[model samples]
Target chain A: MSLVVIGTVAFDAIETPFGKTDKIVGGAATYASLAASYFYDKVKIVAVVGDDFHKEDIADFKNHGIGVEGLQIKEGEKSFFWAGKYHNDMNSRDTLITELNVLADFDPIIPDSYQDCEYLMLGNLTPQVQRTTIERLKNRPKLIVMDTMNFWMDIAMDDLKQTIKLVDVLTINDSEARQLSGEYSLVKAANKILQMGPKYLIIKKGEHGALLFHEDLVFSAPALPLAEVFDPTGAGDTFAGGFIGYMAKVGTVNFNNMKNAIIFGSALASFCVEKFGTEKIRNLSSEEVSARVQQFVGLSSFVIGQ
Target chain B: MSLVVIGTVAFDAIETPFGKTDKIVGGAATYASLAASYFYDKVKIVAVVGDDFHKEDIADFKNHGIGVEGLQIKEGEKSFFWAGKYHNDMNSRDTLITELNVLADFDPIIPDSYQDCEYLMLGNLTPQVQRTTIERLKNRPKLIVMDTMNFWMDIAMDDLKQTIKLVDVLTINDSEARQLSGEYSLVKAANKILQMGPKYLIIKKGEHGALLFHEDLVFSAPALPLAEVFDPTGAGDTFAGGFIGYMAKVGTVNFNNMKNAIIFGSALASFCVEKFGTEKIRNLSSEEVSARVQQFVGLSSFVIGQ
Candidate 1:
């Protein structure tokens, strides 16, 4: 079973307290594909980037065993670029610039070989585009997980809800969850959002950790406390990647499996923040990934009865 | 073994979005002692309240199997009264009034019978008072856990630091941890705070949960998410009470034991927020406490591959 990933593949300039990064490889699809590649071998990417994007970058996807047949290159255009500065606390950021070039009129084309995808990950994108991609699929994937942000809820809420209705799982941050449901209590927010469509909801709280809600069951995963969070640009995307990747690898969608997937996703995201814009995510070895997962096991694992 | 609790025992008026309460029995030591009573049988309270405090309030302590020998009742004076209003979020509050009458000239006199205490809980109070209680104990307790606030750190840094040095575990909120260590990252903040002499540190994140940090090892316990947080008053003190109470019951002071204590503490704190002041905590049964703790285990429990 293959895993399909769809979102932006673009350039990013990030400024954090630790340091600043020049325009480097970033985007929802880029981080998602890279993180998923670590767990699942048959990873397919459907994203649009400008001709300015170098060939080496495409080769990097191939090196990670990701299919590039669906990656489209628009001629005579620049890749989507985002510039943002993170506050001292690393919880909030101020967007400096968002230049959507090729992504403005982008279209996703799924390669015929990618038709067998069993797990679909819709990264943060225009809700309309997400719905279009879902409609384009020949057969609905066994599991469809979508990640969205407050931006869509603020502007294209109708489309966002429509897209949400088509997915099995939805992931968003804490404040976004509050905004979407108009409930300050996350438990109440999760309950309200679950009625809107997705069978599962994951509320990402950055350093505070992530919570997964399904029906009457809830699972909370803790974020590993690090001495520094170099950059948080692609951490959420990376988390989604690891989550879908693990599910695709295990070929299961049960609650127990999802719990483990959350841990795996959290472990991957922890590595993503140790450096800027996929730099840390790109070079991870199997041993490193295993060790990081162990850290999570240590961080949250406890036996009740002694 | 008996657990000795030292802190304010006073009256409080609380206002929350749910409702408001008149002069109810509420204080750090009051909450601490009551929470501890659920775990340990011999819980001794060393605090001073004025004559204005109700006779039935003292009876309530004895009813919970708590020792009132160390409790001093000052004649013809009002008890320390604090009025606070909880915001809509229920995570933060604003102090509306503070009337430190009986607590001002309060001298904590540890009764001779209380000298057999094995666990010591120092709830939020003046650093000098906490230090004095520690010094007054004829024999050092097996374990000392101290809780302090940012207020003390702001006005009496020297005394806070000195008192912190004498404790085995120090519990403070996330922002207070940052303020005390001058570091924004909790991991860095925990490292710096550990240097101040507490062998273990717990950075309580209110609704998010709590983190236990000790030399290179960390364990995170999530707070049980509720549909409503009616009131947050005395939750922290209740947490400390449960933690030390569990430790005293188990008669152990290792990382594993501390992990269980943190979970037990989190369970009790969850109930504290469900109702205003100590109403919920005051009427808990052992079965109810165990069931609450089971919820915490379910919320965070996950099994990875062996």
Candidate 2:
């Protein structure tokens, strides 16, 4: 009924062909909380931010039924800052700058008020921090879905592997799947990664699509072919939010139900990329999100042998 | 309804990690006819062979429903011979030898008995030859689906372009899609190719899957992941064969109908690579194919909230 998302709640300056944005409200917790809150009425965000991070940003999440009591504000410290530019294609991007600031010494502390959440979403973060949050949980959540990237993979593989072993599901892109599993084909990669610990593996292929693999079952969902993908940052986290959020609401762990959750995640992620940072996803209404999900359902549905 | 397929019917020696096959039956028409015959009862093939071509090779296409009538035999000449070695991946291969024996300067003349065929498949071949067959047709068949490769793309760009203008559908792989459209993104590639004349464009991604792009609508069919893929030769043509053949059987040409056709085509192609050349697909029965189609249906199906 509730989710506790542990990740960045910071500022991002993003540049895209469509336009440029000054430091706007962006972060894993920011995006994920907004996406998940659409389906799950209660969301608790546990993250650290600089004093400069706007209180209005906190208000935004609070308005969406997300509790910000666990988001720590470090005195005189700037928030985690990221600046990135998207290429013309928008599938791949180049990070221009990253200022760790308050995030450099982030010590996530789950507040007592948020301990009742039943679902967990660990956005791309340090493996150690992800593991610590899980150990601190008062009770085992119904499900834990975590997203990790190649950054921690290169430097903290040992920690990453340990962290991966604890989660119910793992989300990694195609290249990460290959990098982690050393398998060129994703089918092989999923099989190898599933052995690493997670019960389910979702291989996100950016503009191409995403794959859901559990044991012998596999489901593929294609990205909406939008005319423009202004910025891709946080699309994956937003997808994670939408996925866990929907699952929290539906309260189903069946593969058939999870399949719907992935599509919902994909729908939210599609909206996130259409604008810089989380601008497009921030104000997206449930009706709009539901409409996009329906479109994806339409795009994915086709009768065969009829 | 019956169909006519015209292309090389030849001998192939292939080496793969799974095992090696001595000179085995292969070629566009060989794979295409066998795959297409799965849908329609009778399929007549027009091709030329030489003294070296075996009687069993000729008998291979003799009907359970398929009839080999236009196969012209030339004495004192060798049959079209090809030898290739498949890599461990099976997606790439190196041609060890190519001896275009009686196929050199050969002319294809459809037998009078095969003229009444309602469907036609112009498998990958010389662009001029494909055009010539169309010119010789007594009446335009119900529908024509053509498959061509990148080799002709370099040598006969003009002829291929002209031939493309006449075909109802064109099937090519990702690289060919990029090369033909001069775009890296497949969506952009399909948009440009759709303007060239073919109402439908299917881009094959080998083991990944296939994309059916018509205007802005793109339907992706995930390939059935197999633990082993011995050889990938003829998979694309086999996909095309199943596609057009199923359509001809159902007698419809809508977006929804073609969607099923792509799945049927993908199912047939998935089996083609399980053995060397056409061996795996040769003895394939409708029951096995039905099971695979059900798997495809299961793999791509999902539900979304309204």
Query: Which candidate comes out best when scored by DockQ?
Result: 1
lDDT of 1 by residue, B141-173 (tens): 889999999999899999999999999999999
**TM-score computed on alpha carbons, candidate 2:** 0.94
Task: Tell me how far candidate 2 lies from the true structure as C-alpha RMSD in angstroms.
Answer: 2.3
The model with the greatest lDDT is: 1
Chain A TM-score by candidate, in order? 0.98, 0.97
RMSD of each: 0.9, 2.3
Q: Please list the residue runs of candidate 1 whose C-alpha ends up more than 4 Å from where it truly belongs after superposition.
A: none
Write the residue-wise lDDT of candidate 1 on A1-306 in tens digits: 689999999999999998998899899999999999999999999999999998998999999999999999988889999999999878889999999999999888888898898999999999999999899889999999999999999999998999999999999999999999999889999999999999999999998899999999999999998998888889999999999999999897999999999999999999999998999999999999999999988899888883
Q: By DockQ thresholds, what CAPRI class is model 1?
A: high
Model 2 regions more than 4 Å off: A13-24, A85-89, A304-306
TM-score for chain B in model 2: 0.96
Error of 1 at A55 (Å): 0.6
Calculate candidate 2's fnat.
0.48
Query: Model 1 chain B: which ten-residue window has the lowest total lDDT?
Result: B84-93
